[model samples]
Target: MAMLNQIEAFQPENGASWELYVERLNFYFEANDITSADKKRAILMSVCGPSAFVMIRSLLTPRSLNEVAFEEIVSKVKEHFNSAPSKIVFRIQFHKRSQRLNESITEYVAALRNLSENSNFGNTLDDMLLDLFMIHNRCQIAGSTSNGTNLHKGLSAI
Candidate 1:
């Protein structure tokens, strides 16, 4: 698969690229049909960067790596990278997100999409609510300065 080829070439940078690494790793696993935990663990350890490899090795020092489950290693990595406080901070930032002055609507929405993906806010209702909030709060019409109005009015005037 094209994605599998990309993952085979991928070398994650420590600290700065963990999220992208996990995302691509998951894609690679799915693409290659690697469902066995042992196989998954083997590939994960092999493909991860040196720093991440060392960290995971240290974390598994007390246990036999061969005996450990894939999910357990994934859990440890997720916990290490996405701590509780950081998740809460992400949530708060997502809730308070706004389009900056001179920012286009497309840019704002793209940013929000990324935040929503990383924040794990998978609820359709929450996504709809955020979309509505952004529309009502940030959808400024040209030559108009109104608040608490429907977006249709702005679109109609365009």
Candidate 2:
């Protein structure tokens, strides 16, 4: 509980504020041989969720996450996980936004992949990948439909 609180506090409000938190988390993640799936999930979910949202929103902000900043974020996250980021993470995080709601997820996953690749955190990266898959599934299940239909037919399908 205490550790979780500390971790929450460590998260930065924005990219510029994340430098120190990223450094400390990286150190802890590297020093410990993390074997727990839950821990990995927590770390990635906490870091990636806000990060993805921020990166996407940053696109429209006055000062945004440029290529250099994006790469820096990725590097830090990778160091924490201690593995090369998988391509799936890269596809989600770094790819330019698409027309759908998934644009944010894609950018954040790319950041995770970039960071993991530099740092070499396989287990952590794997955990992130798994979580991303689950999250994607949940999103699809929540909003997706089998066929195109108008409001009346859509309601009938439901």
Candidate 3:
């Protein structure tokens, strides 16, 4: 079917998302009314590609891929490839990062956003980003000869 053709092979080595690939595969099954367990497993095994296949083989250990149920295989692969990071470590990185010289505001913000992804910022992400941006900018302003009172005052308002 047309939908099935859209499924890209899962390749972790290439930075492809196993989560997204599985999501799309699930969508494919829903769209095409593919309810059979064996058929789903077959399609998954075929589509997951070489790199993932090798990973699956290793993760399964003594048991062959055939010995596992579909859900078990999916669980093992997802856990292996998409394991969550330590929140403290990610938060430290997020806090420690500052804009590099020659980096534009857009690039710096993008980097901050990327670093914050696993920071567990939850509801305070926006406020934290604003605070970091302001502190770094203030430091930059202070290092220059120009008066930064106006910027300091503005930042103090928050």
Highest TM-score model number:
3
TM-score of each: 0.55, 0.23, 0.60
Model 3: residue 15 alpha-carbon error in angstroms: 4.9
**Pairs of colliding residues, candidate 3:** none
lDDT of 3 by residue, 8-54 (tens): 67878765666777888899889888898778887888877887888
In angstroms, the error of model 1 at 40 is 1.1
lDDT of candidate 1 over 8-99, digit per residue (tens): 42343422445576677888788888888898888887777576788887877888778789889878767766653465676666777777
Candidate 1 TM-score, true structure as reference = 0.55
The runs of at least 3 residues in candidate 3 whose Cα sits more than 4 Å from the true structure, single-residue gaps closed, are 1-5, 14-17, 81-83, 92-117, 131-158
**How displaced is residue 40 in candidate 3, in Å?**
1.5
Off by over 4 Å in 2: 1-5, 9-16, 35-42, 47-73, 76-158
* Candidate 3 or 2, higher lDDT: 3
lDDT over C-alpha atoms for residue 44 of model 2:
40
Deviation from native of the Cα of residue 103 in model 1, angstroms: 7.6
> 39-130, model 2: which lDDT tens digit per residue?
64346445555654454345435643332344444554545444534666655442332224544544545655654453445555545443
Lowest-sum lDDT 10-residue window in model 3 = 145-154
